[model samples]
Target: MTLSSLPAPAAPTVSPWTLSAFWFGTAFHWLLLLIILIPANVVGFVGEANKGTYLGALTAVGAIMALVLPPLVGAHSDRTGKRLPYIRLGLAVNLAGLGVMALAASLMTGTNGFLVYVLGFLLVQFGNNYATAPYSALIPQLVPPSLRGRYSGVMGMLQAVGQLLGAVVAFAVGTLNLPVFVSFAVIAVVLLVPALITMRGVPETATPAPELAAGPTLSWQQLFSYQPFLWVFITRVLFALGQYSVQPFLQYYSVDVLNQKDGVTASSLLAGCIIVASILSAFLGGRISDRVGRKPVIYVAGTTMALTAILLLIAPGFGTALALAVVFGLGFGAFTSVDWALGSDAMPSAKSYARDMGIWHVAFVGPQFIGAPQGALLDWGNRQGDNLGYTLVFGIAAAFFMLGVLLVRNVPDTAHVKTAKA
Candidate 1:
């Protein structure tokens, strides 16, 4: 069938979410970083001797689930027109996985521990993606286009705050193996309960069942032909690749390369600095994107990230790393806040928002899978002697960031396009 033959999607009639609902809805993400990603990294670092390879394997395994599950559930949600049910289901799975992770890490030994942790993380990844995909779709579905930037900013703020709190907790538990896992498990529940409770009052804005009878079916060529979306997807894939290439190892780098006696302190300090800067930038970047547009903000963000990576290569000590974290945070905050809004603006169709967003998510998770190769690079580099592996990773990361900056230029700011059409 020709692309024109597909029915135009119905205009979305979603209402603005209340501040309370927004807060609760987003709170889940804040805790997600601390409970899931941070703990997984720490576990990977501590669980095995070859930290790079072990961490890589774990992340690679989890990436498969991250890649597969969300889009499936998201597509399902698109058809069923229910977002929260998946979220609730994901919560149960995540909580169960968290408990199992804690128990596994505590009871298992050596390689056994590593395997268990990997298993637990796969579950966490599944649960996390399942819940998050729908939540992500909510922005485009519910938020008025005019307010998308501001709303994204607010969401970014919540995420930054969550990271800040998570950083504090991560530092407290730093490298303490079972305690870190246990803490994450407990905190996940503590934060999640209120989020779920608060979200209970928020309305779901799914397409009606009758309306979905003849939903638009997209061909691969037709889907890829959407220039704005293609660019956005490509941009994020590069961004995630660069970001994760270094992210999982920052703590290890701090201790192993920087020679910090305390790895946990170093990691927490870096995260804290980024969070502090991100807190302000997240709000401001989002607000600014509303006025100026997303492309420029994203360009600035990508550039800042590239510069930050370069600085990491030459950073003198802990103090310098802290300072550079500020730069990184500024760029990250802007990119994260504005980029999300950009993605929403670039949605190909409201009828398949969840499904398309799932494909979009592949950009984010795709990097994790791609980055597994970097672990081999890390191992190869470290084997060569003078901590060359660390340097190489940062260099590659910087290159990726720069490339993303260039790519963003091609993606039209969908907000402006919409305005032009209006």
Candidate 2:
């Protein structure tokens, strides 16, 4: 019933008996998760080099999937206490989907080839979403609310690392042919497997308090009546959609309009800039949020994003573009740094938290559908062939962040707020 009576929290045993292995495992898994997406975006964008319509549709599919699957999967994951099984299963499917993507990219060509590519992407989206919802849900279980910021921040930092590392490696490799694909595939397979092996417990942090949200039980619909939870959900969806919408298009705009010597060169450079800015900002913003309050941090990110969006609108050239990306990344890093802590604060029930989070994951995944394609369509329709569409997209994102700033204010302060007794 108390902390002392527990099994010493399993002592984090991993040969050397350190928490580093847990992080190492997480870093690797994070790589597997992020790199594929960056490269896929590069591939997809390059593939759409001339076909903006196709790119728009690609994101449209993701957006649709984002809206539909949450209640379905959220309900199911909630019923079950463990998330590892889903992770393993999802990775397995992802592996198969990657193989299909490789085959299609290598063998197929033309409009038909793009369709096959989309199908493979669909499989990937399903697998990744399945894994991610449960994966994020598992976080609150592994670490306490106190250490949540450190772990979340580190993971957030390393998440950028994974994206940057993958992008850098892909850039250095100089091609996306069979060999390059295999190299990443090896990384994905190798990292994904060890993450499960090192993590010994299932419910990794907290045991699902079934009494509050016991399932079999009800669907995620059980939480529909809980207004605070809904508020958090709305905030998350708006925030994610705005963020995701601007980014991929920005990557594309960077390559298409900026006249980089190489598209990969531009992507890798922008990625590096974003990653570094993100790490520093995440640390800075997170610490500030901890000291000042979460609302201020959200407001700062929203305001900064809005201003940066306008800057891009006014000056859509090389220096201005990178500047906006840097600012965007910093805003994102700050947001993500405290997001987990904030999410934990908002949850109506810690019982079945992972399942509840899986429902929340829908917001994170849903944006790819709405934002990405919309940007692409704007690009196609306007046919400016410049960064005009990107400017519009980010402008809309800034608006959403403003809305989020208002919403996040409603979330009560549940993070470490009081000083310890002297």
Against the true structure, whose lDDT is highest? 1
Model 2 weakest lDDT span, ten residues long: 1-10
lDDT score of model 1? 0.72
Model 1 / residue 268 / CA error / Å: 0.7
lDDT of each: 0.72, 0.58
The sequence of per-residue lDDT tens digits that candidate 1 reaches over residues 224-297 is: 78787788989999999998888777777887778887776677889889878987998899888888888888
Give the range of the ten consecutive residues with the poorest summed lDDT in model 1: 1-10
Clashing pairs in 2: 63-369, 141-204, 141-205, 141-206, 142-205
Which residue pairs in model 1 clash with each other?
none
- The TM-score, computed over Cα atoms with residue i paired to residue i, of candidate 2 is 0.79
Number of the top TM-score candidate: 1
lDDT of each residue in 36-131, candidate 2, tens digit only: 344354354355554444555666675565556544565566666556676667667666766666666666766676677777767766765666
**Number of backbone clashes in candidate 2:** 5
